[model samples]
Target: MRFIFLFTLISVSFLGFYNCKKQNDLIEQKIVDSLFYTQAEKSIIFSADSTTPFTCLSALDSQQLQILKKTSRNVKTNNDTTNYLVHRMYRTLFQNQGLTNLAAPEIGINRNIIIVQRLDKTGSPYELMINPKITQHSTSTTVYAETCITLPGAYPANVDRYNLIFVEYYDLQGVLHSEMIENQTAATVQHAMTHLGGGVLPLTIDPLAFTGQEIDSIMSDADSIPMRIFLTTIHSDSLILRKQSIDVRPDSNDLVLMTLIKRMRAALATTTGVGIAAPQVGINRNIIWVKRLDKTGKPFEVYLNPKIVMTSSNTILFNGDGCLSVPGVNGRTQRWAAVGIEYDLLDGTHHTEVVQGTSSTNFTAVIFQHEIDHLNGILFIDRIAKLLQTK
Candidate 1:
């Protein structure tokens, strides 16, 4: 009887422990799913495959470097902190599984070092570098932006980085590793180093003036001075109507794109028109704000790098199409009845969707083609000319 009783007690204890562990793991998975979804909604979150969305940061401890915080103070400059910094770098790399690289400062290590997982045509592999300094920078620059793990709430910014940089550094074993980095990698390294130097975006005259609240107010208040800057009219300039626009670079211009998107939406609210473009306000970037007539709210959607990749075989007559660029000049024009478009959303995700046109009076397809033409430097007047010529 004593033996049977002991066995029963042990089994009960083991079952309790097993159940507790299972519950803890389930809770952890929920947290991870929530974070991954949040990041996907707010920023340029990407994965090697669409199926795997969760990151390893959720399994890590609070003190781990993967957690976003002010990382400026953690970087060490000398050889004394090499072993500690390298260990921290590897830990950070492990914690941030999908990340291409990590900086020592990010993980709370006071050492000027970055661990990068690089792949080129030649394949140099994952390596560590210490005390990196930009010895030379190219005269030309590029606009790039990225989301940081630290500032989870903030959108990416249009940051200026050298197109090419000659960097001098030492490896993990204290050997020299000097190289010239160009293009995307150069931009990434420059962005990470900015964190080491204690710089963050909304680099403004008044720090308090640039918070999330202020931005919301600016976006919401249509008559505000900041909003007025984006207000354009037919008489704005020939450049506004004729200049071709370029794609807004995702590398460093995300904040600029966000601000422009907000202002464009606000500007559109004050007008009776259904659409607006970036060049209309003197910015030559390929962006447009348009009302979604098919949607219930009639919400304005921003499109970046928008292009009509496919169109229907049949043509439709747009009898009356006017523009904010040319007032009091409505004309009949020809357009594709159906269009398949690809554009970048605010979160930097690319999407392709088909907008179907009806034989009745649905103008969504017409509006998309119209705004997209503006990006390619085509005006409504040009369409009228083409129609007349074809006739």
Candidate 2:
């Protein structure tokens, strides 16, 4: 996506009235300066008119925060159910916050409903979770670095959590069912559950390692070098790599996302690898840059919130999968020969398409799956080890 610069526009009549107009201008400038912009020289997009309040916020306002913290009442089978109100909250969140999905408590609605939009790029699904609960969380814990759109100023912080969880919820038809969600999805559900309890703290550690001084150093050097220190397999930020990533706030987090796209492109240019994910650079957002080997002329592109819709029944065994994070190790892995994907382009457009692996060489499918796996904290090595355990 092209990065567009937005300058706040002031009205002539308002400017004509007061000696404090200049003072107000300075105040506005200060707010903008404190609020947005990454040290990497990234730019934020704002409205042409200064009179409009910022649509995206680094943190929720008093009203919004209060709503988010409110304990939601459960929906009933009767007409008094808060299902409709929950849906309204869902739409309002996307409209105002540009979030991909939200929990019941976050929208000031009944605790019985949650709306999740495109978590992946293929076809968008309007899935609803009515009266959802984590029936069980796997005893095995994994480290994850988490982030939230509500706390935009806070960086992703390391947290320990169950790698797998059994979630029981009602479908749209009001049928109760259970699904085993693992890896990154497990992390997401755990995070949302925290909100349900009216907890303001993210599922993260206090005094984040990458906060303050370390973050400052990284951003200061972002223009000159890739933030490779934050990528997967880095020993210091090990959990950060394995953690599931969150979606960027299209309205608020646009600048950092834009800068990430640029930096990833530049970093990939320096590497022989075909793709990279947001967590590779330490930003835990659901975005990835991949090389489209199946296409000509268009060498590489970015996918935001890509979803894997379908996988070919037939599978292919590749020689091995390698990663930038894992230095010299390549492990044999079986992957789908073809897959259907839904993802958003840089301009925030949705698309659904199929990617096929070559009969003779399945590198294309391998790369696509590999990069997408990063979003869920899955590395090729992890996949390889899992395969071995099954045998």
Candidate 3:
């Protein structure tokens, strides 16, 4: 009787622990569902042929990494899904399964890292170890505008911004009231998302702003006066509109390209930029220079003659549109808001054109207009619908 009673107590304790864990998971899921900006779904790692999502960060701990590595070893003898770590695996991957076969493949990638598994769902792999860091404050408040949320929902993509800025971004879809934050608001939002996405916090700026209520004093700076350092003109072999060139004479074309590259890097540097045009330098040439996204931000691609095949009715006005060729001057110009440009990516061997799209918001549009205008001997000032009319 005593033995039976002891066994009964042990079983009950085990069941209780499991049941409590299951309940906690459910509650956490519900909170994430209700709160995160994007919907929750299972994610897989980079290169395995499986579709099971690594539902949460806790599921992707270091033990999982060890399991995946072992499984990778197991699959080396027979299957295609067995080995390798690739880009897609770096995030929790999501896809459909069961289409391939009854027996599952043995290896896979999880969390942008590698993995090994006996079966997709079974076995414990070690997680890549992670720890939180506390950084010293550079600014009393780091400014940012929230563009995405992990708590599945909609949010704004673009907002007025400047680094070391105080600004606000909206998410009316969640948190019934628009979240108001500053300093480390971006930090908090990103931190919360780590659990939602099964990843470590990618350091970033704060996405919230302080109104008069939140901040007693906020600074506003004046725009720099415009200057024309590069005496450039938009001259065209106008009719064909095939190509325009900017005679980069004052500085070596190489130096010219280098300087522009530096300015772009210091201001807005993203891999999204493909090339900068000659008209951008104030000479209308069918000339274009491009640099591919690399470990470094340099324009590596160049096009001597380029063409545009399609256009958009959307018109945009970039508030900070200024010219590298023209110094210190920026004003509003009206141009086709977006264009699907066709040009060669600088292989020098292949001549192909695609509908490269542009919008009014970015310096990209300004750059394109600057280059193409040089093709026609035009400058941003000539297209200027509004120059800062002096008082």
Candidate 4:
């Protein structure tokens, strides 16, 4: 993503018109001095246009965008702290505009905003709308610009599109700096309008976390029965079992996440399974509890947003690869002998782990691949089918 920097300096002017008998009231006017930073050009323009209102003025970078998309708003982290501050700034701006009860809109830099420049009637070049409505309240100076573009959607209605941009400012020493935060869209604003159940706060947090009723049902079930498991035998459960899971953000609901981890561990303990995924528990979230046989204590650990980034060329064929969800089924499946995994912990820390070896010496790598496959909506039986097809 590209960055579009705009440093605006506002000067208020009052002009009085004299009539024949009396002096007319003074009219307040605002003049905006805008400076844009780009790789190609850098220029300053003085604008008197007060008709247009800026749609959004702040944005998040690509990394912050990913964090915003993946992580929920329920959990607190260092990144979340930064995002919260930005959100507060937007909230204040919206409130000042009489747009109360609105969620903070996500913003990001658009590629077009970097290259395209629009000229007004006076031939003054302006990349974004210069609205007098936008007023800066913070002591820290802000430098950012945004443009809204409307695109045709698949349906009859047109989709409003806004390219996201990150906001940064210059300090007293003239050093450019930014705080990491995430962004939202206009669609998100509309959604928030309809769903005001969360009040003024943005409902960016994931709602797919396990409900109390669902949790009670799973916990109360017989130890031998996998009540929470979404089985291939069941038609409704199979739908979720076949779908890809979303990443579990570091800021996911702590109570929900801990409950899931506990229930998954309990479910795994019921059987001889080495690992259990959220999909197996009828939740399509990127979470897994795996028994780390390679570790000294051979403990079970939970990995959120786990992904198998790399695999060894050498393959291992397990004669009886099985699954808790696919009970009564065991088939030969080929898996990587070694695999590298990237995952996150509950504390918002990231880790990369490599597990390798034969099934006899270490089955951790195979287990990792199997669980991560579930996150991608792949089943061990599917692997077995591929093996049979090759034969």
Q: Rate the local accuracy (lDDT) of all candidates.
A: 0.61, 0.62, 0.34, 0.51
Worst 10 residues of 1 by lDDT: 51-60
Quote model 4's TM-score: 0.49
Q: Write down the RMSD of all candidates, one decimal each.
A: 20.3, 24.7, 21.7, 17.2
Q: In terms of TM-score, which candidate is stronger, 2 or 4?
A: 4
Q: Could you give candidate 1's per-residue lDDT for residues 1-391 as a string of tens digits? A: 2222344456557756777766555554443343222332223223223233223231124454343334343222333334543654566566654565666555443335676665432674556666677889999998765555444454544467889999877665555678988887787777667655644432222221234543454455443223442222535566555778777643223344466666766666777888888666555668888777767786778888899999899988788887776766888888888999999876778999998754334578888888898888787778889878999
Ranking by lDDT: 2, 1, 4, 3
Choose 1 or 4, whichever is better by TM-score: 4
Instruction: Name model 4 segments beyond 4 Å from true.
Output: 1-24, 28-227
Expressed as tens digits, the lDDT of each residue in 1-391 for candidate 3 is: 2222344456557757777766555554553343222211112333234443333222134564343223111111111222222222222322222111111111222221222121223342211111111222234443333322221122222232222222122111111122222333334333332322433223222232122221211112111211112333323322222233433212222323334433333222222334444434222335554433331453454444455556676665555455554546877766665555655332433354332223433245445555556566555676675434421
- In angstroms, how far off is 177's CA in candidate 4? 38
lDDT of 4 by residue, 134-178 (tens): 122233332211212210111112223222333343322234444
Q: Where does candidate 1 stray beyond 4 Å?
A: 1-236, 250-253, 358-361
Worst 10 residues of 3 by lDDT: 98-107
Cα-lDDT of candidate 3: 0.34
Instruction: Write the residue-wise lDDT of candidate 2 on 1-391 in tens digits.
Output: 0001122334324554675678667755564444332332121112123222223322346666765665553443222223344445555555655454566555343254565553433575545666677888889988776766667666666567798888887664556778887875676666666666665535433442334543454466555466663544457666878889766433223444565667777777788888888777766667788877777754888888887899999877677678877777887887888889988776767899898864434367778788888889888888777778888
Q: Estimate each model's TM-score.
A: 0.44, 0.45, 0.27, 0.49
